[model samples]
Target: MLDGLTLDQMRVFVAVANSGSFRAGAGKVARVQSAVSHAIANLEAELGIALFDRSGHRPVLTPEGRALLANARDILLRVDAMRARARGLGEGVEPELSLVIDTLFPLEQVGAALTEMRAEYPSVAIRLSIEPLGGPVAGLLEQRCQLAVTVGEDFRDPRLELRALSAVPVVTVVAAGHPLARQAEGRTLAISDLADHLQIVLTDPTPLSEGRDFGVISPQTCRVNTQETKLALIRAGLGWGRLPLWEVERHLAEKQLVRLASHALGRSGLLVSESYLAHRIDAPLGPAARAFAQSLMQLSGPRSP
Candidate 1:
């Protein structure tokens, strides 16, 4: 009975389930509503299960249908991957090389990589996404990207390979007019003194580092999703936080923000942030992807500061 089931039927089932009605699903699959209904009816007949409960205004998945929905999605994903791999084998270049990068990676380094990538693979399409905290790694895990440059900590997967990129300099900073800046009399402040103010923290939506505060100094904390937002808050004197030195160099020089003495904050004078270029071990990158990755690595190579 299951042998009669086809990919078309599975697609129709998924479309109807997602869209909530045969008419809506028809619009999605570009077929007539009757055709969509027929496909699902045939699929249900073959599987001998009532996939949808159509008694209500909207169709809802039956218990058996709910059990099979995940399997159907997985099958479709595998089929898509097989098709993509086959296409890549014939073309020698990926149709699109999706690259996700951490926002903390120097903009100049990314620009250098993109310049080289464009020169080497003019025809290959590049999809670039900038994320922060756990987002870069999440992009890789969720199959949104084929590669990533990440600075997230303690995140590892057996299916991924990590290549060392470069270390970014992280600095604790505050607006020049901030209370902490005003209180510091050209000396480091004690932990208790610092804890009185708000310490902005960068947090990820993902559960990667649940209940953890990476560099928070104060018990009073503000959590932000991205570094740019954190930087903006620091500049507004709403809170103080850490940012990559390269990112705040201009602000520091312009007197918009001032770097705190790390020793007074009970930290080393220097905190080096490490980044990595990561790709999946199971799905090796195509030529264009490899070239783009190499370009990023080349630009991020060791240099005397």
Candidate 2:
């Protein structure tokens, strides 16, 4: 009974059912209306069922046709996925590219690079993680990710291969109404001025950087796990802290936050931290991973080491 069943017939049937007319389905499937009609007729004959009711002006799916439509769609989807995966395998592309990026890295650049990667390698699945401090390096070390974009210069591990990506400007910021902002109108505040205020610090969740403190000047401190939480607390005038300048540019422009003039941070109160593209020296980059890494480098313009 299923002797005449073919993918072409099922495709035409599904197209006609979805389009509600034989002519439209023919156009959709890029075949003539006669071919579409012939395909549907063969499919219905093979299945021994009336797939469509032709009594109406436009064809309507029968109960049996409605029931089979979902199966047809699912089959097509699986076939497409199979073809894509097979193509990727033949071309030596990785099945998936897992990447872990430092939370301080600009998301806009990441998004742009991903957009390009998707267009170039549609079959290669992406697994992305945004982690703070040593979390990114930990993911790479634990084999959770194949590539990592990390901030700072603490990556001295011989197991990793690093390439300088770009420098991100870190700036100390406080809410416009914070006491420090009000007191430092035209003068640079000394480190002693910040000692009393509760500095909302981003703490590393991983033991890889347990004993390290980056740019912490406050005696009274409030530790947070995520940058978003720290930013929220800072916006609430609860404390002051250093954040990537790109992250707080909008708030600075809107007058919601004010940049602190710190004598420790020199004249501009900006610290440029180098971010790097890292991967294990032992694990060679697959095609997809290499492509994505190239895209990131192109987007950020790789810095001279």
Candidate 3:
């Protein structure tokens, strides 16, 4: 009926819908519950449609409510993207970039990306810190790194701007001489099939599958930590596992290890995800950092020689 509702109102509406309660939404949107309720009430009055089916003990989206929820989320997300882009515009130009890359990342690809970055921003300094995944997030949050690379399910932090780098789903892998090598010739390897083999597994410093950890998989197994050790163990005919394609695809082609088969042992979409150059709300990033941020995005995908 009227376009008088504020962006804050729509944000509250979306948060309530997403969180399923005003209290939860307030926590999510970082406002008091009273403020959240007031925003939703204001939004409903301006829109001339009931945005929630409040009859339930908990808030539920009515048919009409569900319809508007989608549009409202779209609006708020675009507003966020715009805010980020507009902020980028003020960044003038960047001269140096500090990056903290995960230690498990393929060095070859990282080197290639850096080379392209160098050619494009010759004067820009590219400093890299290769650490465990936990360290990169802290580096970004603390302003130590302009960009970070991580995998697994996305975090709930609103400060970090995460971008999906790639998703090469997990595949089954075994040493060249494993008894199951021939069985993997066909598509789709099953987990139960590994019952007999000595499974050489990796214990990543942090969980690889994000919060979706199925639990400790104790195969008739040997445990390793870093990717290199696990790969070396696989080469020694230890056992089988679901591994990221980027890490093992080349080896599979080179006939070093045999990919068993696609499994339901699916990874968390096998993501090589990246986070933006971010600082807290009060701490603004400079033009040099902004330029480096753009360069990181441009250099993310598969690059040319």
Candidate 4:
């Protein structure tokens, strides 16, 4: 059996659980399929227990696999902190900046700022990528990116600093034709009333895709990878799920969608996310990163006092 796993192995482990296939996971992580296969095999060996069971082409997580997921998350978080600090050393006065974010945030404000910034600093550029929660954090830690803006509290790295910018409202929604849409017009529901409901969820690790995290109250959940699908499912009256108020505003105004019910089901708790911009404390920022962070702050505007 292999010994301790490295940062690379932990990443591969996450990809497999996500993609559900070696080839697909490899493509996402930018590795060859065989390399992904080898990584998972070696990872299982190191842990002294089979993480996944070969049920066919796809692997199923054994009981042991579920236990290791948390550990892997911890290991990756530490490695990510080290990487950010290491990259800081290389960013001399001004270096290229990588900006990663959760798509659910109000991007319109930042989008305008970015356009203005490009004309102002043509020489400085930003590398941008969007993923669910862990991937963005991983990018910063892998030195693949410099800093990240994440939703939720998965970023518990002590080496970094986190800030709460705004408290966005989270509410359950469904397409107009759905059953929940009717409930919104009539009355609110109790937690136990949703036992037979199918909740449409955007299951990406990012905040925009966090409908499943409320599973304690929603036992019947369907995981969806894309925004279009979430809308489609809700429209088909197949499921109901939560979404950020920022994104749902226009739709609600247009009467395209409605809230699930007036009441909470299964002790549902709303997710109040603190937008965090994390960087290595030991490493000073390059001119580009600093300037960009400033621009981001300016674009984010101010929270109500």
Candidate 5:
């Protein structure tokens, strides 16, 4: 008997329960009141359960109907999603978008872009990875990710296409109580002044950038893989390091971290790190991937020098 139960019957059942009347449910499903009532009656008979109580002026869901309403709604929603996914595939939309982003890129911008992407392509799944230094590029080269956003202006790889996104300011900072912070109070510190202090630096996990160090002036150093760990260690007064200004702006404003002023930091103790959007030259982006890329570009605005 349950094998005879149909989706139309479930739909009519849910519609009547939600609208609280057979006539309203019929209007909701574009069927007449008699047909709606008949579908509900068939559903109830098949399950041998009283789905509605018609003892009152308007129909009301019975305890059994209430118990199963959620399951019925879930099934309808999944079917809708499956249909959307099928339509998207037929339209050449990618089933999934895999993106790897550099740790230096502002997370807020990434979140905003992804939010837009989700609204525009709900059927496309997203796989996101946050990596440091060479990791994003490596993910692209290895075909582990379909797209990448990374820092650095120098991508000489012939197999990849790179477009400038924006420039993120990198600032040298230390805990408010660190010795370096105290040293930079009166006057600008010289390059030699940092030689004695332990510098915290981010290391690339991939061999693509193995043994290569960026902006390492201090002889004594602590190496970390993630930016958060480096920031935490620096906040603890264990060391000083260069971090993205966007990441530490609040700390700097709250007096938790002090920006270092030094002649060694060329250009007012600020370094402009250029970021780029990258992908393989061999593989073009699909509809969903292209939409996501456009979203990122639009949200990021004009590239900063």
Candidate 6:
């Protein structure tokens, strides 16, 4: 009789229980069906417990097997986690990671990625900063962050590298009660019509977006430092401006903000903006930083139309 069970045996047992058949479990573990059946049979004999009711076409977990299932899973998970941690250490995971992202990047996506990163790398300390326009790229240039998720065209900087992430659609929105929203309630607003209202714009800290404007029709503009403030001012009927469609989808559904139909901006009415992830050439990325970059890219698929 065996006093201790191997991780392979435990894996086979769990697979058989969950898959409810020896053949299916064999497929899952990539082993022959006879190998799976033998493993389970030996495991039951060694433990002196009938783990499954084998009378049926497909084996069903016996009461003892049900009780042992949770413990077996716990052990396999811990062992797998140990292997992952060792691999991560070998891959050079940084003790601390710093990141900067554009304020225009979807908050929901960022938040979800951050949550996943924390769970995957609880030992690594992470610091995140939010900036708009040039702030993201500037962070990498100044060594303020190891990685940056930014919006705009790629700059011709020899020391920096970037990957195109996703293109976000920009929607022109205003407070439901704003004059522009009321005026363009059922009709598309022309550039001339939009030029009459104040436009809310986010100011860039770096020269990247200096003297450049996108979808700004009005000569008069209200400049803000952050996206939150821009959204607030727009919601308060202070001004109208374009924002990422993902950022304002809930607000539009709630009727807190109204989308303007414009013939000039988007293909139909939505303007698309490109975003990228950048890192400095001199700064080699550690495991943690690389993982975060992957997370950022993965979320773009679901967010993109």
* CA lDDT, candidate 4, residue 123: 78
Q: What lDDT does the true structure give each of the candidates?
A: 0.81, 0.85, 0.65, 0.68, 0.85, 0.82
- Among all windows of ten consecutive residues in candidate 5, which has the lowest summed lDDT? 80-89
* Residue 2 in model 1: lDDT: 83
**Model 1 clash tally?**
0
Model 3 CA lDDT for position 63: 88
Task: Give a tens-digit lDDT track for model 2, residues 251-281.
Answer: 9999999998887864557778889989876
On lDDT, the stronger of 2 and 6 is 2
Q: 1 or 5: which has the higher lDDT?
A: 5
* TM-score on alpha carbons, each prediction: 0.68, 0.68, 0.59, 0.61, 0.68, 0.66
Off by over 4 Å in 5: 1-91, 302-305
Q: Per-residue alpha-carbon lDDT of model 6 for 1-305, expressed as tens digits?
A: 56667889999998988888998899999999999989988888889999999898778899999999988987876676566556656776689889899887876777777677778888989788999878888898889998888875633454567788888777889899999888887788888888898999988888866777755678999988888899999999998998888889999999999888888766546777688888876566777777777887888753543
Ranking by lDDT: 5, 2, 6, 1, 4, 3
The deviation in Å at residue 148 for candidate 3 is 5.5
Q: Show the colliding residue pairs in model 2.
A: none
lDDT of 3 by residue, 127-214 (tens): 8876544556667667787677755443334556666554334456787878878776655555566666676665444433355433
Candidate number with the higher TM-score (1 or 3):
1
Enumerate clash totals for all models, in the order shown.
0, 0, 4, 8, 0, 1
Deviation (Å) of 146 in candidate 3? 5.7
After TM-score superposition, the amount by which residue 301's alpha carbon in candidate 1 deviates from its true location, in angstroms, is 3.0
- Scored by lDDT, model 3 comes in at 0.65
Relative to the true structure, candidate 1 reaches a TM of: 0.68
- The residue pairs that clash in candidate 5, if any, are none
**Ten contiguous residues with the weakest lDDT in model 4:** 262-271
Local lDDT at 298 for model 5? 80
